[model samples]
Target: MFKGALDNIPDRVKVFLLSLTIMFCMISTVYANFYIGIDKVYTHIFYVPIILAGIWYRRKAIYVALGLGLFYIVACTVHDSIIDPDTILRFLIFLVVAGVVGSLSRARERFHSKELQAERAFRRVAKDLQLVLESTDEGIYTTDIEGRCTLINVAGARMLGYGTEEIPGRKMHQLIHHTRANGTPCPAEECCVSRSRITGVGCRISDDIFWRKDGTAFPVEYSSYPIISDEAVIGSVVAFRDITKRKQADEVRSRLAAIVESTDDAIIGTTLDGIVTTWNAGAERIYGYTAKEIIGRHISLTAPPDVKDEIAGILGRIRSGGRFEHYETVRRKKDGALINVSLTISPIVNNAGDITGASAIARDITENKRVERELQEAKAQAEMYNDLLSHDINNINQIGTGYLELALSAPNLDRGVRELLDRSLEALQNSSRLIHNVRKMQEMKATAGKLAPVDICPLLDEIRAEYSGARNGEVRIDLACGNHTRAMANDLLKEVFSNIVGNAIKHSAGPVHVGIASEEISLNNKTYCKVSVEDNGPGIPDDLKPKLFSRFQRGNTKASGRGLGLYLVKNLVEGYGGRVSVEDRVAGDPSKGSRFVIMLPASA
Candidate 1:
C-alpha cells in the first residue's frame, strides 16, 4: 500500500512536499533555539528536515543544509554570540547527513524502478507461455526439484482428470504416473520425470503408460526436459501424447508378416536388380537354404545355369510393372538337382504406386513334371508299336500281291483259279491301303512336317492318275482348279486327297465320278485355299458323320480293315495349319453324295 501511494504521487509534487516539510522543520528548530533555550537539544529537530531534503533532492539537499546553517549563524549573531566550535561542528554534521541520505535514497529509488519493470516483463512472458501450453494437443506440465507439481497446463490437467488448482504442490508421480502398464507399482525414483530432475538430462519414453483420473491407462510417448537455472537443475517439464493407434498398427503388421512366413509355397522378395531382400521359412524348406543364408544374395542362386537369363527377363518385366502367373520353369536346389516349379510373380509397388521390387510365390512341381514325362514316353512307345506293325503288314501284302500277279500270268492256270487270284489280289491291295493309312497316322503323331507352298492343281492331277490306275480305270476323277492355285502344305497333302478319293471309289456301286475343285477363300482376315472333293456315292448318315473322322471308325461294322484313313487325313491337314471336314454334296440329300472339303493357308 505504501508503494502504491508513492507510485500515485508525481515526482515534482513529491519533491515540493518534501521541501516544505524541511523548511518548516528548520524554522521550528530556530524558534526552539530561542524560546525553548539552546540547552533543551532543540537543534536535533533540524536533523529531520535536513535528512528529508537530502533523501528527496540528492545533491541539491546541500543548499537546504547551507540555508539552515546560515540561519543558525545569523540567529547567534543577532544574539551577539561568539564564533563557537560547537556551532561550526553542528553545521558540518548537517551537510554530511544530507549527502549520505540523498545518495542512499537515489540508489534505492533506481533499484525499485528496475524491479517494477522486470516484474511487468516477466508477467507478459508467463502469460504468452501459458497460452502456448494450453493450446497444444500434447499434455504439458512442470515439477519442482522435489518432484512436486508446480504448474500444469489446461491440457495436462484435463488429461490427468484434475483441475489446475488441485495439482499444485502434488507429488507428480503419485498423481498420474503412479502405476506401470502391467499394473505394477512405479516408484518415484523410477519415474522418468523425477529422474530427469536429478540427472539434469532429458529422457524420452515411448512404450510406457500414464494413468488417467478414471484409473485407466493408455500408451504414451513422452519426453522429460530438465529445467536449468544458474547451472543447476531446478525442475523438469514433461510433454506427452497418446500413441494407441500407432501401437495397434504395429501389431497388425507383425501378424501379416507372420502369416507370410508360415505359408507352404516359397514366398520370395527381391529388388528390381534381382537381389533377394526377403526369404521366408517356406523358401528355406523348398530351396534348401535358410533365410540367413539366402537373404541379401542374388536371386540367380536358385536358377539353373541354362536359365540364368530367365531370372533377368523376369526382373525386367517386374521393373516394367508386369505380372507373371503360374509360369512353369526349372530351378536348381541346394543339392544341384533340377526341379520344376510354377511361379507367380508380381511387382511390389510403394504407396505412391511406383514399382520398387518384385515378389514371387513358387510351388514345386517336380512330381507333376515326372508324371507328365512318364505319360509322354508311354504314348511314344505305343505309337512305335503301331508304326512297326503297319510297316511289316504292308511288306507282307506287297509280297502276296506279287505272287498273285505271277499266278494270274501263268499260261496254264485254270480260269476259276485265275479269277480267284484276281479277287485275292484286289483284297490284298485293299489290305495294303489300310496298313499304309496306319503308317501315315503314326508319322503324323511322331512329327509335324515342315510346310511350304505346293501347287494344288498339279498335285491333285497326280493323285487322280495314281488312284485311277490302281482302281483299274473303275473310277474317273474330274479336276476343276486354276493352274496356279497353291496352298501351304507338306508331303502329307497327297495322303489327305488319297484317303477321301479312295473312300469314294470303294463305296460306289458303279464307275465312280469324283470332282475336285479349288478356290481362294477368306476367313478371320486371312486368305486360305479351299479344296473340295465331291463324290457321287452313298452319303454318310447324319448320326455317323459326327464320329466319321474319329480313329478306328469304319463305314460298315463288318468292314475288313480298321478305319484310320479319314482320321489320319484330318490330323495331317491340321498339322499344316489347315482344316478338313465332310458334308453332303447336295444339302439334305444323304443318298445323293458326299463332299470332302480342305482349307489351307493360301500361299502367294
Candidate 2:
C-alpha cells in the first residue's frame, strides 16, 4: 500500500513527506533527551528515517539523513552542553546507511529502465513487420503442421475474398484450395503445407488453382517454404499470385506456333544479324534441310553461292526497319540445285517498339518460272509463223488478183467468162483484205507503247473520202466533228472508222449510207471523245450482237462479214484506254441498222 501511494505522489510531495519523517525522528530524539536520560541507543535514533528515505527516494535520502542527524546533535548539545563520541558516531552511521541504500536503489532503477526500453523496441519491430507483410502485393500466409491457417496478411485474406478477422484458424487447403484444378476433391495429404511438414523441406508448385470466397477459381502459381523452429519443421509460408494473363499468353503463343508449322509456305525467323532462329516444316521441304539442321545456323546456308551475301543484305535492311515483299530470288537446296523463291519479309518488333529480328515467308516459284519460260517461247514461235503466213498469203492473193484482172482485160471474152473472172477477182480482193486485217491486229499487240495524240476529225474526213470513191460511187459518207476532238491513239484509229464504212458498203447490194459523228464527252472525272458510226446496212441480229466483237462472229447471215473488222476496232480502242459498244441505230428496232459507239480518252 505504501509503495502504491508513493508511485502516485509527485517528487516534491515525496521529498516533503520524507522531510516530515525526519522531523518526527528529530522530535522523538529531543523528547528523549529532555524527558528521559540521554542514552547511547537514543543518540542514533535518526537512522530509521534515513533507511525509509533511501527506500523511497534513493540518492535524495541523504538530505533526510542530514536533517535527522543535525537535529539530534543540536538536542544533545543543549542537553549535555558538549559534542560526545556517541553523537559523532551516530552521525557517521546515518551517512553510511543513506549511501548504502541510495546506491542499491539507483542500480535497481537503471535495470528497470533498460528493461522497459527493450519491451517498447520489441513492440515497434513487430508493428513494422506486420505493415511490410500486409503492404506487399503477393499473398502471404502461414500454415501449421496440420495444414491449418494460423496467420495471414491482409493481402492473403483479400486474395481469398475473406475479411482479415475471418481468415485464420481454418484449414488452409480447405479454405482457399479445396479442389484440384480438374475439379476433383483435393485431400489434405496432397496439400502443399502438409507435404512440406511431412518431408521437412520446402517445395514450389508453379501451376495451380486457388478458390475465392464466391466459389470462383483462378489460376495461381505459388511456392511453399517450410517454417522451422528449434531445428524442426513447424509449418509453411506460402507466397502466391494470379497467373491468368500468363496462361492466356502461353495459349496464344502455342496456337501461333501450330499455324506457323502447318502452313505450306516457308515461314522463317532470323536474328537481326542473319542467324536463323526458327525454321518451320515448309522450310524443310523447300530447302531440303530439316529444322534441326537449319535452326541456329546462318541464313546464308540456303543462299546460292552466286548470291552468298543476299541473306545478310536482307538482314541489314530489316535491322534498319525495312520490308521486302514478293521479292524473287534464287536459293540453293541441300542437293546444291538452285530454285527460285518469292519472299515476303518483314521486321519483328518487340513490346518496346524495338526491331529485334525478321520474319520471312518464302514460296517456291521454280515450277512457275519454268512454265512462264515455256509460254514465252511458244508465243515467240507462234508470232514467227503468223508473220511468215501473212507475208506469203498477201503475195499469193496479189498474184491471183493480177491473173484474174489480166483474163478480164483480154478482148472478145464471153460474158459468162467475164462475169466469172470479175467474181474471182472480188474473192481474191476479200482474201487480201482479210490478211491485211490480221496483220493490223498483230501489229497493234506488238507495239503496246506506240500511242500518241491523233485528231479524230482528220481521220474521219480521210475515211469518208477514201470510201466515197469506192465501188463506183456506190457508198455515201457523212462526217460530223467537234473542232477540239482529239484522242490518245496510234494511226490505227483510221482503220476503225474505215472498217465500219467498208462493212456498210460490202454488206449492201445498193448504195450504203454511213454517218460518222464525233464529240467530246466526260466520264468518271476523265475527258473522252465519243464517236457513233451509224450504218444503213442490214442491221446486226440481236442474237449475234453480244458475240459480234469476238473472233469468227459475224453480223446478219445474209450479209455476214469476215468477223475481224469490228473485232479489230474493239481491241484498238480498248488498248488506248477506251470502250466500244454496238446498239440498234433505232431503239428497240434491230431491222433499222446498227450503231457502233466508240469512246476514246480525249487528249488535252
Best by lDDT: 2
For model 1, how does the per-residue alpha-carbon lDDT over 384-462 read when each residue is reduced to its tens digit? Answer: 8877877788889989999999888889888888878978997898798777776776566656666788899889889
Instruction: Please give the lDDT score at residue 293 for candidate 2.
Output: 89
Question: Which pairs of residues collide in model 2?
Answer: none
Judge candidate 2 at residue 228 and give its lDDT: 91
Regions of model 2 farther than 4 Å from truth: 1-188, 191-194, 197-200, 210-218, 226-236, 259-306, 309-335, 338-364, 401-513, 518-529, 536-551, 562-578, 600-604
lDDT of each: 0.84, 0.85
For candidate 2, the clash count comes to 0
lDDT of 2: 0.85
How many clashes in each structure?
0, 0
lDDT of 2 by residue, 1-604 (tens): 6654655788788778767867777677666767787554374446667876787778878877777677767777788789888888777788788989987778867876888889889989999989889889888988888877888888878888999779778888888878988989998788776788889878888899999999999899998888999998888899998888999999999999999999989999999888889999999989999989888888998988789878778888998999999999999999999999999999999999999999999999999999999999999999899889888988999999999988888999999989888778877887888888988988888877688899999889888888886778777888889879999999888888888777777777777788999999988899999999897777877888889889867766555347788889889889999989989999888888889899999999
